[model samples]
Target: MNHTLTFNWMMGFVIAAMALGAGQAQAAYVIPMIGGAQLGPMDGTPMKHLDISFDGTNLSVHVDDMVPTPLLRPLESPDEFDPAEPWAVLTDKAYNYQYGWNPAGFITLPSNSAIWVQRLSQDSGLESYQRPPASPPYASIFASDGDIWQWSGSMTHNVYAVLNPTQSVYSASYRVYLGDSVTGVALDGYGSDDVTLLFNATVSAVPEPGTAMMLTLAGAAMLRRRRTA
Candidate 1:
């Protein structure tokens, strides 16, 4: 091989290696959540706010944060991705009573967004088991927009939001409000807060070497074995 050709090939190898490293570092984010009803003072009317918080300084869920699950058939469907859980909600016996968010009322999902939720698992305590939920280790909770999902802070429920894959990037905005399990009314009068999740699938990070590279390495090993023999 000529010197120029060898140098060019080596540079390409370095670039590919860098790409692999960047992809690993930028792997889609999985946001863990800890939420509970934060009650207001007794001097005024009843007000309850479900505070959804994470460790990030700017709590905005950026476009790069979605969990990336590539499509099973990547060759056939290169643009399409698979449904994945980019975020999960869990509790730590924070509160005792059973509380929930009403999708029909206070909770608002992005319009025309294909997003659903499933309860992966939970510890014993629903008050315990608010309603007879489907057996878990991944029980589909609410697929439709109006489906109501309730949980108790007394128990540990791991809830995952699954986003269906499409050609374009997926983004969702959630307006969460604390709801009364009985009358089904918004407890917090000030419904000014909301959390938005934006996911971009640009970093195609999962690595698999090319067929040519594999073949070249095998050839080099065979040559070395022949010389030793």
Candidate 2:
């Protein structure tokens, strides 16, 4: 083939490869909140305001500060409440007991998406009251706008309360799970006081192997054209 024809074919292949690569790459981003305002005077109020960006794909949040309040019925024997295995109310009304806005504040997740919370780390105290254990892991704790609180098996108990008067600091990392259909999440700190919270997220764009190979081939084509010229 003539040089002109060969060059044209190579250019076409490169453009096609780049388009294919771009299509295969999934975009990812991170949203972070640092040094947030404090919440509360122990008045059973929610505080701390923050915002989150959820655009369909997987995202994670790192929380530093604030505390979560687990709502359970008053137990006849408060001592019987185990911090390690705190119980949650089983009834659908239990949603009221779960408070998501305490530690990290209110979070709005994508509509119609099944949410998942994976605890990475935490430092706080659990205040337990006698209440029936909700379904395992308390998945139902978060119910759209009404209830957005989350709990971790690794944490102390059902209620993540601040007991010390000296302002003890708390920090935790969590992986938020949102189904494919959900997008655009919002979080706010409304009931917390005397504590500062911070959040950070890491996003990545993952490309398929085929896409990576095509990108490499496209680079080679450019180099060949340069040399021939």
Candidate 3:
């Protein structure tokens, strides 16, 4: 009886250890279409809009035409674009969305220049852009959960185009990565020619929790047979 009880205790520990270990291991989560976007009117008010994306690890925001100042730089190069400093925030224009957490600070645009925010983790490591949280100072917002976002481009020329602010046209060429650890990617967009908005981007992950549970149960049955032998 004593030996049998000890064996049962060992089995319980083995199960608990395995579960905890698996949880600690890296897992991915993807958000299909995070939330809706709000672009300001073309003529009357200075428009503000947000484009969000996730690569299982990071979140990015693109604030376009939030201010009406002439674009200091060209729109063709979407990767190197940066927001104007001193943070000119346009309250009249904004895009709201929920990604499992209440965001603290929002990416601000002065309506003059184009700016995009991206989050990357050290785990993503070096030039390899993957879906990871942004390091300090680079992020205007700190997300609580696993989130990733990217910026495509802005609509600066079409002054009268705001009544129907189309998604930026350049969003189609952009690529999002998760980390050096995984691969296999897909991308989507929001706007038209010369301008494109990246509505959202996501990378697939391991089987969901329900599927994992089923696998665990199956493994447990096999373990029981070995223990009996």
Candidate 4:
């Protein structure tokens, strides 16, 4: 066997092996949802729940429940609401249902992906969106459970293209919010206005360096055998 040809073959094998190993090593990345109800004189305690997971190509989001506390101040008239906003605006305060209470935080993910609804609980007032407005950055909104003031159920949202092999491992971010209403509404100040929920997710991919190295070594061993023959 020609020396040059043998070297080429060996390199190819090593590359292949490394790729394989790296791919196997790649695993999902999980992020936990952290937050709960917010209580204040002007604000009502609404429970927001979330669970998220990412397997490189797809992102799964689940909403456990969203319940608005009766303690919230009710709107005096319909004119206090804003129809143009993606979220609900009641009276002078704006209730952000598009993104969870923490609008500043978001999950990282890839671009140009579509969201698939796997499960939607009946009567669970939850609305969803791929992208939302800019003001208060948020991934999607799990709208209210219809006319019902409180909601209890789970819904799965699968977001595709969460990770791209060609781009950096962490390239995109996803923000999610779950609330009782798409547009802010008046709450009757009453009991504990606590929002209870959970959010967890993960992102992952196969690495290439290690796998490539293994392939190269294998190729070299084969090449040696050929030479001996």
Highest lDDT model number = 2
Candidate 1 local lDDT, residue 228 = 100
lDDT of 3 by residue, 82-160 (tens): 2352111211112212212112244333223222322322111011111123232223331312233333232211111
- The 0-to-1 C-alpha lDDT of every candidate, in the order given, reads 0.32, 0.34, 0.30, 0.33
Worst 10 residues of 3 by lDDT: 155-164
**Clash total of candidate 4:** 47
Candidates sorted on lDDT, descending = 2, 4, 1, 3
- The segments of candidate 4 whose C-alpha lies over 4 angstroms from its true place after superposition are 1-51, 57-73, 76-79, 82-112, 117-119, 124-229
* TM-score per model over all chains: 0.27, 0.26, 0.17, 0.23
**What would the TM-score be for candidate 1 when compared with the true structure?**
0.27
Encode model 4's per-residue lDDT on 35-70: one tens digit a residue.
111223244443343454444443445544454322
Cα shift from native, residue 49, model 3 (Å): 21
Q: What is the C-alpha local distance difference test score of candidate 2?
A: 0.34
Ranked by TM-score, the better of candidates 2 and 4 is: 2
Give a tens-digit lDDT track for model 1, residues 1-229.
Answer: 4756654565566557656767653333322222222222232212122234222121111222222321111111111112353212222212211122222222232222212222322222221222223344344444433444443322223332222223233333444334555443444432323544322222233335653564455456556867999
Best by TM-score: 1
The runs of at least 3 residues in candidate 2 whose Cα sits more than 4 Å from the true structure, single-residue gaps closed, are 1-45, 49-52, 58-113, 124-158, 162-167, 179-229
Model 1, residue 140: distance off in Å is 2.1
Could you tally the backbone clashes for each prediction? 2, 22, 26, 47
